[model samples]
Target: METVTISPKYQVVIPKSVRRQLRLVPGQKVQVIAFGDRIEFIPLKPARELRGMLRGLDTTFEREREDRA
Candidate 1:
């Protein structure tokens, strides 16, 4: 396991290997989620990456609406 030190300003540097593995870049947003006793850091996707993820969801939602009606 890699070790990191938190700076006095509450900032910690993610190691180079970990950053490369996670595909993290400078100024990228990260989400810190609390899971039980540990925290998970998830990288936020850029808006372009989220554009078409809902393509099938729209049809599913319409089908559900029609079923309810």
Candidate 2:
């Protein structure tokens, strides 16, 4: 695993290998989420680029009786 130190300005530089592997560009945006203790960085994609990403996903599920109508 690669380690990075947060700079005095509260910024951390993502390593080169990690950047290349994730195909991250110089100005790409990422969503920063914090849960419990650790943080997660998720790359944000444009809506147009997200087209048909869930194709063939199982979307059918049983509904409750009262909600079925």
Candidate 3:
């Protein structure tokens, strides 16, 4: 658990340790969400970087007789 103080401009600096762990670089955009009372920050990645991320998964499944074409 970490504590951070919000600056007068309503900005808070993410801690170095957390930043290093999350590989957060400067100028990276993050999606901020307000969940109930606490806020969350999710790092955004380019669609190109996410390509082929789910390769080789078990996709086979049993199909109903009427649904099969």
Highest lDDT: which candidate? Answer: 3
Q: Rank the candidates by lDDT, best first.
A: 3, 2, 1
Global CA lDDT computed for model 3: 0.94
Model 1, span 1-69: residue lDDT tens:
788887999888899999999889999999999999987889999899889887866443345555765
lDDT accuracy of residue 31 in candidate 3:
99
Candidate 2: regions farther than 4 A off: none
Clash count, one per candidate: 0, 0, 0
Worst 10 residues of 1 by lDDT: 57-66
lDDT of 2 by residue, 2-68 (tens): 9999899999999999999988998889999998898889988889988999999998899889995
TM-score of decoy 1: 0.65
lDDT of 2: 0.91
Query: TM-score for every candidate vs. truth?
Result: 0.65, 0.80, 0.79
**In model 3, which regions exceed 4 Å deviation?**
63-69
